[model samples]
Target: MGRAHVSTHQSVGGRYRLVEITRRETNSVRWYADDLRTGRPCLVTRIGLPEEPDGAAHRAPARVLRTTESVARLCPGRIATVVDALDEDGSLWTVTAWIDGTPLGEVLAEQGTLNYVRAARIALELLDVLDAAHAEGITHGELSPGQVFVREGGPVVVTGYGLAGSTTAPRLTAPSYAAPEQARDERAGPAADLWALGALLYTMLEGRPPFRDRGRPEATLKGVDRLPLRTPVRAGPLARVVQGLLRKDPRERLTRQVVREVLTRVLSEDSGAVAEAVPSPRLRGGPALALRCADRRWSGRTTVLGTTLAVVTVTVAVLAATQSLPGTGSAADAPAASASAPGDRGASRPPAAPAPSPSGTADLPPGYRTYRAPEGFSLALPAGWQRLDTSRGADLAYRVTFGAEGDPRTLAVTYSTGVGSDAVAVWRDDVEPRLERSGDYERIGSIRSTTYQGREAADMEWYAEAGGSRVRTFGRGFLLGGGRGFSLRWTTPDAAWEDGASREALRTFLRTFRPAAG
Candidate 1:
């Protein structure tokens, strides 16, 4: 193979520059120019093939050239200028703006983890750029930590559009951040870029790719396909959201809208911030719970306060030690015999329990609430549990504290609409397989049946490994009225619920739950 030549020339006092290149192999050369009209450096790519007997440089097909032009148009500001093929040197090169900043990969390597707030800001900024590129029917086929430029302004992408439409001979190496599909020479699209975004986000948070190892490409690819991410201890809700986006099945990953929503919450709101560094739930003897409710009829009222109330009521037993003493007052002074009677037990019912309040201080645990239907369904919660009301889709979600009052595990629930068979099938087929293949889980048990909600439901228990840590997950799913249904999951380290008492406390709550009246 012969070496390619490249030369850059800058016009006096002008930001624009010209790049001249020669292809010794093809015995052809081309001169490409970039004005840098947008006050940014431009990227130029050149592909050269060896000359044939006739010594003529190979020309890229018209279709490929058209595709390159289309990509350039799709990415405007970032790509101040693009030159697909100036001449036939058997070489094709494209130049995009030279964004100033260190690659994100370099930053991470230098700094163990990007500051949470800063990383979030960078993610949002990058997504904005990606959204623009995606809108133009172009994809950053090679999105990776190395391809991202982190400047004071924010993070910007460095590579896009050149690789996909290249007419040069196939290349073997691709950035690890590239989606499996793109690596396999499949059609690269917006989804591929999003997948890379997910990978990038994962790397920023966890300090590594979701599926990474010091291994060969085949092993790495297999890991990417089957491995579950090792959730970072420091990662907040944004990390989980990103992990979901990084799912191997592109179709199973989140859409651009979803990514935007999550990034928005993570960046703009204080609640999106990850909780203070705390011991793993496993070490603390509890599991981390992830919950969601999809039934409109359920009213989306599951929360920390509500669940806490139920837990408290069920966990604490109020016993009346009565010594038969004579009371001369009216019947109002008389202790009631029935605990279920309306007025009879009114005064005895723990002062109507102060409606589950949460201390708003950042240091204190938050409170949550559960749905109370008109049909009369209710449960008791543990005392002192705090609730968080500021998460994305907070209106559709409720979060509560688990374990002790001050510092404890967290449980969150969100409601979704338009649930149907397809959704269920996707979960059963696509999502489940990925989870199993990740090698981070051990199935405890699963139950499939129809509940009072009139929809098919499944109850499952499993353990998931996060950063070499294990957390037990217990979840239940049931279809609600209409096409909607819901999933309820509770996660804690096995130690927290290891005892029969704690286990029974959770089980009791689940057993007593009933659909609200229609």
Candidate 2:
């Protein structure tokens, strides 16, 4: 990367006044500038040119403006709106509307690492923009952390459009993020853009680019083309996504639709996605709106658990079952076995005081404590039990699991804002059928109508294999008005299902539970 020759308080083309250097990259610099003619703020980027003839350099301005105009129109708010592009001072300078957020690169530099959920949101945002651009036959070859701006309470804003084919150069900036084909100086295609998206995602989660900058463009490009890729440790559910997009062969890269599916699934697991949906797919009649969780209560709980994979797939299919589309609803997924140490939960909390039942007789066994969830629910959990996983869906539906290290039992609490008024029909018609598909699953008894806390509810018991171990689950689902409902699922190893400990825990959970203080 070359240092910018322009200083603060200078004017480029005598129309925009540069204020300060906002960001620097291996091949370009970004400046915060003001428009002399309009008095509005703008972002100006200056890139060092490849050794190309003047004829090619002169056309760079028109190419950048023209191509950016095409993409900005198609993506509207998702893309940076370029106001001008010009060749001057032996460099290419492009200016666009100022974004009111920090650069993705800067955010990572300061924070060091982001949890996978936040990264998933950003990844989905990037994927959506790429889907829009690729649909119009545009390729953003120069996708990098610096090209993306993350705004507060808004979607990400992507810049650096049209820079890929700006000149004979394979990539104009961020060579480390360039795809293998681009590094080899071969003609880059849409797959190259996907590779860059993977690299950007890798960098966000790992706090460093997949390929390192070797202090020279050619050397870094060489490593990108020739070196082995290190598998990411922090990607969690996103590991597959990163690998798929960063494949060496462009033709082998994941298609846009698949990437969107994986990215949206990761997003749906976040507590924040429920409040806001993935931006309506850019294309009309695109895939159904992905389930997003708006539960601010679990917003900070973003470490993706490997055990949640089963629940994520189920969450994606919940809408289909509700609509009688195909599959049925099954929240009876495997638990995150021993993922956390016992001390991680509230080991020091005193034993819960007796929860007086209508019969005037309820007491938590010793070593149990009352625990409250941010999602507006409370229950008595065995000592050392911690929240192990959470999966969310649209309309604020979510499932949270609790378990302790070395414990073969787990309690999962689910809340859904969308459901039918008849709880039995929900289990019999919409849920049980889906449970049948979860490997060696069998119903223990007929679905039974019941009552839970004065609400119409249903009970279903079943046995299924979870991670090679036979497991038993007792479930109770109850309905509230306006299509809202909640479910409590208590799972244990089938061997332990009839034991006194398992029975006592279930009774305490059901007896002491309290809904979000509504």
Candidate 3:
């Protein structure tokens, strides 16, 4: 969680002092608290229990505490490990280690729409944890955005694993995120969690939940049971997967295996190719196309045709300004005017604006100068930074990394001839899968598709644990033409991602990068 902006001096259990309110869902609130006894930070959740007879109220806290312990033992670091659970003054309080991440609901609220590929990645991670639970006959009855926390280093931690059956009330929190079975007052099993997963994916891709909260729990659940789903305009390649999981009938919904396959497919195929064919819900007066997953396979051939225009855009152009500007571009900062020319895309075009001068003597930002590579690339680099590593593929793909000896930041440039037709797909399918296999890999958000230097491009950001520190990376890959492309990757420690030095480096890299002459 980010730093608390507000504090409440209220104390619970007399030993736990509430420092901040992290989140509030229906009938519950989560807080960051200081364990006055141990002088440590912890997360505490408080839920109001309904009046119960037959000692049900007495057993609720024990059930939650026991289930959380068992599940945490089974899933390890994936789920929050409960340290304590107590019944206090008509409320159930479950406390765990203080997690350094943001709630998934907060992320969605701030970012609005996410990349379908990114959403799929998060869903896959959640599914893995859920799979472990279901195999052990444990169901995450209340799996909603607020129950998931995303750490800066890429892994997500889940909470509220054992709350499903603790209460006789159908759904205890976030009624808008409730499953159809729960809304129907049916016994929710793993299928209910699947539905909640689908609802979460929908919320992540669309700014709002599929069912609106009517300020009352019954009304929200009624909407979930009766309302027709509003078609997702930006889901792109995830339409069918979302719809399949959201089936009104539990038995008819897609199984977990099938859902996984569809989400995995979206990362590998071009979303636009299948999106144009699916019929979307008619809104107001007209119909729109729902961007559903393509049932068919991607042919080895690329789908997008290259333009005759000579403009060559680099994929890294956007990341240079990703943090500084949201959906906007910087002033004239083309990279072809200096030491290189655009590659063999079969066009003769005018030269781009000149690259930044290598002599720290130019009008460049302080502490930075251009580096003209013998391989035909040039970019402004920070002082003292040098080539750190290089690797190559059998198919003429190569990557070169640059960084200072002691600095925790690095930039990598890659060039390849066997590029796929879709830049976004290349990152989501090809590149990301490889990264996932690497140690502690976690993608931050969706792979974004945007224009770079007047050409098609894609950008992906993620995090990995390295040497006890969380490292965040941003990558951009763009095609030249005919299965040829270039990519640039930048990495920094998560804590320093927003620091001025890192921010300036990104902007300078984007502003001064000169592509190699073909």
Report the number of the highest-lDDT candidate.
2
Q: What tens digits encode model 2's per-residue C-alpha lDDT throughout 332-411?
A: 32111110111111111112234335432246689888887888778778889999887664445567889999987888
Which ten contiguous residues of candidate 3 have the minimum total lDDT? 323-332
Residue 374's lDDT within candidate 3 is 71
lDDT by residue for model 1 (1-518), tens:
01111223423124435442211101112223355565544444433443445533333334335655664454444332343333332334444444555556546554545434455556666666666656655665655654565554423544434445443222212335657665454676777777877777777766666665322345555555555666655455565557656666666666665555555554444332333212222222123122211111111122111222111111221211111111111011111111110111111111111212122121211232343423233434445543433222111322222345553333332222223222223233223433565577665543222232343444444567755667665544454433233444555665564654445444433443444444
Residue lDDT tens for model 3, 274-299: 34433333211122222222212222
List candidate 2 stretches off by more than 4 Å: 1-7, 270-518
- How many backbone overlaps does candidate 2 show? 8
User: Roughly what TM-score does model 2 have, to 2 decimal places?
Assistant: 0.53
Q: Considering summed lDDT, which 10 consecutive residues are worst modelled in model 2?
A: 317-326
Off by over 4 Å in 1: 1-75, 83-97, 154-157, 165-173, 183-185, 213-219, 226-228, 272-518
